[model samples]
Target: MSSAGRVPQGLRRVYLNVRPERLGVLIGEGGKTLRDLENRTQTIVSVDSLNSSVVIEAATPETPIEMVLRASDFIKAIDAGFSPERALRLLDEDMVLIIINLKEVIGDSQSHLYRVKARVIGEEGKVRTNIEQLTGTYISVYDDLVAIIGDYEGAYLAREAIEMLIQGREHSTVYRFLNKKVRELKRKRLTEYWKKDFSTKEVKS
Candidate 1:
């Protein structure tokens, strides 16, 4: 199936592809995971294991298209190596999945891609762990793709750090950048919260 894009608003169907190996993860033991997804999104998910294709259809006319898209993203995230628990975060309104194609970044050369993946992953997963901690994002370095799941700001920050590492930046440098950005993000959020709270009080008065 071709990559899914925004469709006209309404109950609709979407198709996504999953790797054959990861189908079990998507299905879960006894189909619990897939059922949970369908329940949460109010959609029906059908899997074709032979084709590694998934079809998601809105369960009712009242079902929102956004929910359908969310299901699609949830599957894509898991297919990209995110654990089911981590992928579930996409159900949240603020959480998102950001994937970086290593081939697009460096090249199609397997060795080159492997080297870049190693840099993002670091030894013993220290770098990936640090990035996740610093940006509050969950990252997966799977095959030739690096997937990030988090709020938009955190996910973008994590992506930036990974890109820096891919560009041969020192690990320490990437960490510093994340640290600075994360602090700024916190302050911005605090400022926005107060502004919103003040406006609410003003209207109440």
Candidate 2:
């Protein structure tokens, strides 16, 4: 069958597995998020509550291709540790960072890298927020790089703190002083994310 004719023959189905709880968030209040996605990508998105999977069906080959690409990007963002509710927050602003030379301290295992990155970002990003608040910067700890976004002064402070931590600074010391500085910065905060695009774009292009 021709591509156009085959489109209706189950040729445009994309499946996504999401957590049961997240399904509601993705669907949004009154199905706003789902409807937006469908309207934008020109694909019909249906959720299967029984299996917690999303099915995307396109009316045309072109639409399906675009839908798949966009859907994959969304899925990747979620799999990379973002909540569906907060996914859009990252779409416009870049909030990720990759720290180099991390392997030197934590070794190259995937699990170890994640553990170290978690340490850098902290619980619910509290640590990172402190760094940004103190330094007037936004920090994102990714696989192999620590990203810093903010004004010069804030970035400098954050960089220094990260360096100290990596050089074996005691967590207690880092936390105490870092918290103080962030508070100060918040009062005088005047910085921003210099590189405003997500880190993925940097690597891809």
Candidate 3:
């Protein structure tokens, strides 16, 4: 849905579409979720269920578009198969959403795409679960899309692992790579934290 001429003068609005089946999830039980989102963002979310459309309008003319965008992202995460609680994590500034389109990688071959998707999912969702646990990310395989929500580094790492699966790498190989890289990342973060702490202590001394 386009907001080009629909928005009133001096008002900021964002338009987005949720999957028809996910619209109720976006709205929440008895509108509780939608109300919470508006309360937090200082925006009004208008849902057009018939069209699977959502329009987020600033409560006042002074509201920021950033807030609107954030709300949009939250809705999108839900549409991509995240529960509201998981999608709410995007409210944190460091969190992000990354989507991988399987059709693009597998070149319109449904059988190839199915195989790749299976590789990412593994038997009983073990592969997907492993990547999420190791990387601290949420992975959702819906249709031909893989959606991930996490901090930037975690999301990127998850994306890489999925891509490797698509490229026909052995699952064991991917798991090993993830384990090594996650350790490296932890070490790097620890080093940075200690350096910052040392600097603070030096200043105090």
Ranking by TM-score: 1, 3, 2
Worst 10 residues of 2 by lDDT: 90-99
The segments of candidate 1 whose C-alpha lies over 4 angstroms from its true place after superposition are 1-11
Error of 3 at 62 (Å): 3.4
- Across 96-195, the per-residue lDDT of candidate 3 in tens digits comes to 9988878887889888878888999999999999999999999999877899999999999999999999899999999999999999999999999999
Deviation from native of the Cα of residue 199 in model 3, angstroms: 0.1
Choose 1 or 2, whichever is better by lDDT: 1
lDDT of each: 0.91, 0.61, 0.88
Q: Judge candidate 2 against the unseen true structure and give its global Cα lDDT, from 0 to 1.
A: 0.61
lDDT of 1 by residue, 1-205 (tens): 4325434444388889898999999999999999999999989999999999999998876677778989999999988999999999999999989999888878889988888988888899998999999999999999778999999999998999998999999998888888889899999999999999999999999
Question: How much is the lDDT of residue 203 in candidate 1?
Answer: 100
The model with the greatest TM-score is 1
Note the clash tally of each candidate.
0, 8, 0
Winner on TM-score (2 vs 3) = 3
Worst-scoring 10-residue span by lDDT in model 3: 2-11
Q: Rank the candidates by lDDT, best first.
A: 1, 3, 2
